[model samples]
Target: MKKIIFSFVTSVLLLLPNMVKADEGMWFLMFIKRLNERNMQKMGLQLTAEEIYSINNNSLKNAIVQFNGGCTASIVSPDGLVFTNHHCGYGAIAGLSTPEHNYLKDGYWAKTRAEELSPKSLYVRFFVRMDNVTDRMLSVVNPQMTEKEREAALNREMEKIQKENSEGGKYVVSVRPFFQGNEYYYFVYQDFKDVRFVGTPPENVGKFGGDTDNWEWPRHTGDFSVFRVYTDPNGNPAEYSPNNIPLKAKKFLNVSLKGVQEKDFAMILGYPGRTNRWVPSYWVDQQVKYAYPAWVEASKTAMDAMKRHMDKDKGVRLKYASRYASTANYWKNRQGMINALTAHKTADQKRDAEKKFAKWASKDANKAEFGNVLSDMENYFAKTNQESANHNYLSIFFRASRITPLVVGFTKQLEQYLSSSSDQEKEQIKNRLEKNLYAYYDESYYPAEVDLFADNLKLYAEKSSSIPSELSQVKQQYNGDFKRYANDVFSRSIFTSKINFDQFMKQPSAEVLHNDPLAKIATALLTKYYQKTPEEEKLADTYAKAFRKYVKGMRDSKISTTLYPDANSTLRLTYGTVKALPADKRNADVKENYYTTFKTMLDKYKPGDPEFDMPARFVDLYNKKEFGRYLDKDGTMHVNFLTNNDITGGNSGSPVMNGNGELIGLAFDGNIEAMAGDVIFDKKLQRTIVVDIRYMLWVIDVYSGAKHIVDELNIIQ
Candidate 1:
């Protein structure tokens, strides 16, 4: 262990000074002191590296957490007040909403702690510490081993390391691979499961601009939500209970009401999701040519199907609101990626870089180790490209089959109940299955399921190269008429209706399940997928091995200077400066000032529109010019600002701190021109959109009249 630590620290110390850019790289916190502290200081950082990340004492890392494994959040008050993006909290908010109250549309404010609502499941995990265990992990791996053998050996060591660090499950420990298996890091986290929703602006303010303004610039969405973490009286992780008290955080960030100006230093601290900046051009071709188009089409199909039901019934809207948002967001994102990647010519750029790398590696010693890497990757991609559309279309259809999951879950228990001779045991199993089926029904309503099922079948036929042999008869009988086939199946399938499903479960039997149309589809499709998995996995392994060698060779040849690992939802620091964008380069209609104001946001408002409607009180306040101290000196309320910080998916809700480590804004979205950013960071065009902290405070104090909640925060002006 000591040797591993020493080797990791030495490697970190050897990092080249000028290799990394101030505006690029999602850096690990552990090496901040040795590698980034000086550069960060020169860029206007005020705190020491230890103050940013330390295991023994309170530091900035304590405040930042992985919110539910998907998004990032920060501790803002000593009472465990958590701050994250509105869309990040949308699922929980939608779950708590109803047609009558509609907390999502009207927004909600907990005036007191007692009024805060807890979702059925919502949690926040604090970063405890991290250790680079690369050497230790590689000790069990060797070139002679097959991929499966290497994986098994590594998993054994990881399990032991994780268990040792878990402290009897008190802390969650995970070891994630980085740099294409070239490095490994151990992350420990403590989760508090008693988080409750506190306050959120109405969707008008929170998600303003909606789909129309999704990735566009000059952004004015508030995009922030509030929650609080609660723990046992002893300040340990605990489930939700009335007796649980608000967690007294070891450290919390103070909100800086003094808004950031253009050229002001901006740094983000959070768990960024992933970036594929080093991918080969061949894979990029696959994504652009085949994979993404299929995903975009299938996602749009699901979104439209859900919207048809949601728009007509308010209850359905509340139920499927989050689903529609998630589907639409990604659908648009893929479309944007296709356009942006083509316009930016990212594949061409990647080929150019690869050419340079090849020239550098032409020498004898380098050639022996890395010569076949690029060729092997090319071969793998060439083969996979043929099936890309088919794979994605089929995969999407399987996932869009919501009730299929319930059927699978209930199938195992039903089989058990059938085999049991004891009446008591059989009855118990039946009871368990019924309860869970009901729960799944509520989560995925019957109307939505029927629509989604029909949509999936229609899309699968439209895009997939071949139909499952089991379903071929049905397809042939209908003469490939998807609508007719869908209607017939949905009408017969018990899975589409809750009452029918429940009644059928009362006399559950394998014969009935085997005959069921939905079950047959799930079984046929899943079996077909698994049957092809071995070959598919072999091709994937080929890509993985080649990429790993390619990355290592690049490092050895000095073709790749900065070697920061891609994000795997781990804590990282991305620093840059608040900047402006050229809205139009041809005519230069707008230079896109760093800040957006309420007046501009109001200009885009449309009455009674789901995306643009705001409460009358908010408009009234604006008309009266009821500006508080939160306003700028020019008497305008700043809504959003732009920064050049390097970030991606999970960085949503990350605190955009100033040079002084004070919260200036919450990093939310990236500009549209930089939609190709996940593949290649365009330093000239990429911009991180942030909700100015003052806007959040103004809505809390003046709009929601939740000054008591505001008083808890350490507000710095």
Candidate 2:
């Protein structure tokens, strides 16, 4: 371990003086002292690297956490008051909302700790520490080993390492591969599962522009939400309980009421999800030409189907709100990626980079180890492109349909229950399944709404190259009319209704399941979706090996001057100055293109429109110019601002701090022009959208009159 740390730190120190632009890299926190401390100091940082990521002391890293394993969040108060993006907390908020209460629409504020709501499941993971394990991982395999053998060896070693570092399962330990498979790092995290919802703005303010303004700039969404982490009396992780108390956090960020100005130093700390900056051109081609278009079309189809039902009934809307938002957000994102990648010619850029890499690898010194890497990848992708495309289409067809998951999940459990020989075990499984069915009926099952799955499935059949052979008879019976087939199936399937399910459970048999229409479709879909030939699997293994060599060769040959690994949900810090976009008519009213204000947001408001509606109280506040202490120096209430900080999906709700490490804003969205950023970082155009911390405070303290929540924060005026 010492040797690993010493070698890694030495490499970072050697590259310190010649690193890329401040806005470009998603950098590791452990090497900040060697790689970024001096640069950050020169860029206006007031704290040392030790103060930001120290293990011996409670540093800035202690305040940040992986929210619900998918998003990033931060601690803002000693009582463990957590702040994250509104959309990040959407599931929790929606879970607590009902048609009558509609907290998702009207919003909710917990004036006291007792009023805070707990969702069925939610947790936040704090970064405990990380260390290099590449040498130990690689030591288990050799060139003579097949890909399967190598993978098995690595998994065994990884499992051993995880068990060793888990402190007897107290911490969640993950061994993640970086740069494909060239390096590995094990991350230790302590999860606090007793998080409670505190407050959020209504959709009008929180998700102001909805999907229309999701990735676009000049945004007004107050995309922030409040929650609190709770733990046992001894301040240790625990599940939800009435006896739990608010955690006494190790460190929390001080909220800054002072607003940002163009060129001011900005820094962000969070776990960014993923980036594929080193992917080959063929991979880009596959995404743009096949995978993304299918995803976009299928997602839009689901959105349209869900909207039809949601529009007529408020209950349906409340039930499907979170699911719809997720589908719509990605729907727009995938399309944006297509257009952005095409316009930027990102594939061409990758091809040029690969050309250079191939030339470098051709040298006699490197040829034996890396010469065939690019060719192997090309051959693999060329042969599997169509199969890959069909698989992607079917994947979304399953993902976007509510019925498919329940049908598949329940069927799997039923099959397991049938196979059990022990009467005691069978009874327990039956009871659990019965409980789940009741929960689904009460909370999630909406038959009328899910009827749209027929249309979604029809779209899938039309877009995909082929359907499973098992479903070919049904397709032929209806002459490929999926709507008719789906209707016939839904009218008879036992899984479609609780009474039917109860009756079927009394006479459980494999024959009945085989004869069931929905079950047949589910079975066929699963079989075809996962069916890959052995030859194709072998090609995938070959591709993986080649890609790893490609990445390692690029680093060793100095093709990638700054060898920072791509993001894999690790804690990283990115710093840059607050930046402005090119001048545009839409943002002409603003003093600069970097920031947006209430007046501009109101200008785009549409009365009674789901995407652009303005709350009555918000209008009154704006009309009265009731800016209060949250107003910017220019006399307008700033809403969202731009920074050049390198960020991606999981970075949503990350704290965008000033050089002094004071929280100024919460990073929420990215500009649409740089949608291809996941594949390539365009420093010139890519920007991180942030909600001003003052705006969040104004909403909680002034608008909602939650003065006690405001008082918990260490506010810097």
Candidate 3:
């Protein structure tokens, strides 16, 4: 009977082409020549594969980098001028800004090299090279080995791979699993630590739409920011130094003033963070119904609490600006994902695909390896749905509340002290812990806002089926009102303020830490959240093995021919066209839905509005039509444009280059219509939002009169 079921599914699966669209997939650079170059050229790309990626020669790959390990950025000038999104550099900019300087609010431009500011920590990782390591990696594991044993063996081999490729510790080497661990690849990178800020548009312009228009279409934000990478006198990566100079880049993209047109070829190269395009139906269902909602609600709760205090005090607002924007961005994103996944019926689609896969696996030839894979996954997801939901909420609680870390840190240091060997070692640990405790309090502790954040804990407790016992006990004592409990803790706990912390450090006691109210809450949350249940432990081992076999079967059967591995923060090239969505009357004034212009900015502008307000100079320039060379043939200055190039979170600062490989725009966002692009590409709706490079040049050369900066760029008119 099982064989019959498998035979039927196999027939169905063979008939299907796996539904991978021409424009989908974050392809590896090494495979571009064989897998994508021809298709890309047919779509209008003029550059040869060798011109894009070459291990021994300077190519486009040399100009692109992973910005600070989280975003993409490109080198645009011989002087190492780096271009990326303003939001990508927000943390560094905010750190450099003071109440008096207010760089973020008023905007910043380094008139000369000496004016650029270096934050305490900022780096860019240039991709050196990558190679297939599948055979080497797979040799360490066997089918009969448990998942834990497989993982340990693979990790040991991966460490050896890294060491071999590190070239005496000069390069950072990473071994990443692909196709759910059926294959592996090793990447080599060189990190430059002396990156310095160059320029940015004022907050009003950079974040023009703010939270209200973050993931929405028809965006008018000037979202680009500039930085410069510095190196030692010998042009080697080094720590920050006054003696360091701008790097003479081996390759930098030529800035193209010519704007994009509908159907024009577009390509993006960056480190896309993550994707799960081949997951089973159960995983998608769990994310939509349980995980995403919990995250969305928890994020919103924290955002509202932070905003309330932020609005009341300017200093507080400045301090929490980055956190608020980050929380609110995900708050909208998760909700968008929920709406999109449901609207697109993505789960149903996955289910249909899985049925075909199951049938294929059930065949007599394939039955032994994959027959139980789907059942195991389904059973695991079913039992852990609620637990998964609770886990997300608690995770957000820890991230949202700053106090949790303070308590956790103090407790860990105390534990270390107890385990120490001698009085001298204990004293040294005590001194270091005391210093960190004070610093944490100074930077993050805020009693009023933290107490307000605790309200989220109550929300979690109410929404989750189960919670930490310590949290439950607190709820019982406070009659389920977390606000009172938080207030009591803040008033008495040492982690609440430096005065309290300093006093406690003078006479630190393990009993005090063990009995502290905040410590109890923190310990309960941390212990329960990190400790896996026996069921989860068993499932983890089983799930890993099952998925590995499931993907292997798909490939072995030729069902996923030409399928690229999921994005895992590696250098990849995705190419498509400057595609437009269905014409909306809202954008009737513009030529097409592929891009937006200054007119859209004015239309959405609101006086004194945080998101829409424009700088006086910007408004004056728009009124005078001072677009200069940046003006489009349509006689408008393009702000943000759209393309069908597949991208995700870490692709934020990625360069959106044209056919000739000249930089045209900066890929900063994805349209809300296809927020599910992270998991599944909706070829028709998924579009990468880009800031026109011409607009960035205008902001610096014309609007801000920083032409010296423009003189460094290799501009192609």
Candidate 4:
């Protein structure tokens, strides 16, 4: 969610005399600032002087823990109890429950350590250290090389780096490019293969108002989950084992009672996904006018059909809640962004900036690359702009249905094939496939998806008449004749399963064999008047190249930015400072701060309103002012905090640290205003939200009465 700054007034400056040069320089300055803001600086964060001194003096890096196999987390206890967001551990919790044992609905608690539930597959990872390997790695690649040559060189460099760093174990090492092409960090991490679920609250508490309250503030969703890591008899990471011992983290955060107050210094460390701050203005306008709106409409239509089916089918709802929630969440966020973008006049500003840059580049030789790239991007957008929105929709729906599952299945099968001699591989593959099957069966509607494609075909037919009168008759022929279309197109395919798909791929004319249901729909839309069109393939290749170029450009630019490579199951450290800021145009004057009490929660309550109803447990806790042992720095109530840390999807369970590196909170959500933080993060507006460590301990001590687990924590009150 990159927020673009667009101002129409600035657009006119592009044609102005002296102002054009100033505007061009300002754009570059902005770009540099953005890059520096997101760059990794080891333990260094964007903190105030006092905050920096605090973390440098007191922070304990070992407190951070990777959780439940995939997500990031931090350990609060020495005996193995770990803390992370409820959403991070939701899948495992949801997976273990049946209709009768609806953990998601009623929640679950292990009364004793012996009764704690073991997840079939869960693990945690811990970061060891980061080493500077910029020159050592990039020395192998020529800077002036082509994209393909650069990619190959990078791959070779990474292989060498991994080999040299390998400890002759299961540890993974990754070389990450940072600040565009200016720096590189090599990270080594050990991933624990065994982790187990400990506890979670009911949906009423964990999810609270569900989607209605997802990204909103003054919130009361107790988004927390508990899990424990286990090691084998030899103290080695392994699969679930009864004989396994609790993991002893090299570093763990001591639980703190002093919580964040207004303007408190805080920071979050986690992996954040993509951002689009550097995109051209034309691209931004296209997304605003065409891309986001079209997808939202398509998603709405699909959701309606899915929800209608779910209402009549309980099994479908139960199995597809995760999928639905994922889609619904995106839909909500995108809508919010659309509104915010318009309010901020982002598109207009971007257009103005682009024109100014172009004018400046016309004179400057050294800075010509900036304007040239901008021009290329705009040209590319113009060529593919009309089809881009529909392309995304097609990709999403089709990938959700067929491609993703195939890829996952293929990966699992490959792992199994490679480990044919190991019995554990077979067991792991079986478990993975079983879970995937449930996911695929629950969320995918093969017949309905095909029908949706059929509908899209007809819609395209109606629209294609505007393209050319020569193809008008052809468009009319397929306007309502999907039955014939499907038979003639899809029926010619042999893409039923992996085996068939693989066989088709091996054929000399494999492209001809790709006439599946999805392809039929694509062909109907792309081709005009009985003539085949290569537009689809051409657009696909262009997009692929664009993405690759973007990645390559980041690697070569040497700009200090956080646009790093993906996590290759390796340990990495990210640093940023914690600060509260206004939510851009919406709450520009109001400071985003901590802990809206039960009082604030109650104020939003409407007795007859089912959506706003508080659960009895929450109400009771509120009435009791069950502050328990948790209290803020000022001895007032505690809730959440804002940090200027950059993070992403994989950073779910990451630790939020103070300047001293002590664990103050567990990083969870970013403010709704900062939804676009992933791309073009704004230090002024972006803040990572976290559940206070004090609050977590209070729940364990006062609510669950899990003193045994509580005793494990080194509580620093």
lDDT of 2 at 328: 91
Worst 10 residues of 2 by lDDT: 443-452
User: What digit string (tens of lDDT, one per residue) describes model 3 on residues 426-481?
Assistant: 88977887677665554453754565557778888899898877777888998987
- What is the C-alpha lDDT profile of model 2 across 1-66, one tens digit per residue? 577678766876777676657888998888778788888888889999999998789999999999
Per-residue lDDT tens digits for candidate 1, residues 642-675, read 8899999999999999988899889989888899
Reference-based TM-score, model 3:
0.94
Q: What is the per-residue lDDT of model 4 for residues 438-511, given as tens digits with 9 covering 90 to 100?
A: 45444444444344444444443343223334224434666658545544433443332334444543452424
Best prediction by TM-score = 2
What lDDT score goes with residue 11 in model 3? 54
Judging by lDDT against the true structure, name the best candidate.
Answer: 2
lDDT of each: 0.84, 0.87, 0.85, 0.56
TM-score per model over all chains: 0.96, 0.97, 0.94, 0.72
**lDDT comparing candidate 1 with the true structure:** 0.84
Better of 2 and 4 by TM-score: 2
Model 1, position 687, has a per-residue lDDT of: 88
Ten contiguous residues minimizing lDDT sum, candidate 4: 21-30
> Which regions of candidate 4 are displaced past 4 Å?
1-59, 66-71, 140-146, 179-184, 312-315, 347-371, 399-593, 605-611, 631-636, 643-648
Report how far residue 382 has shifted in candidate 2, in Å.
0.9
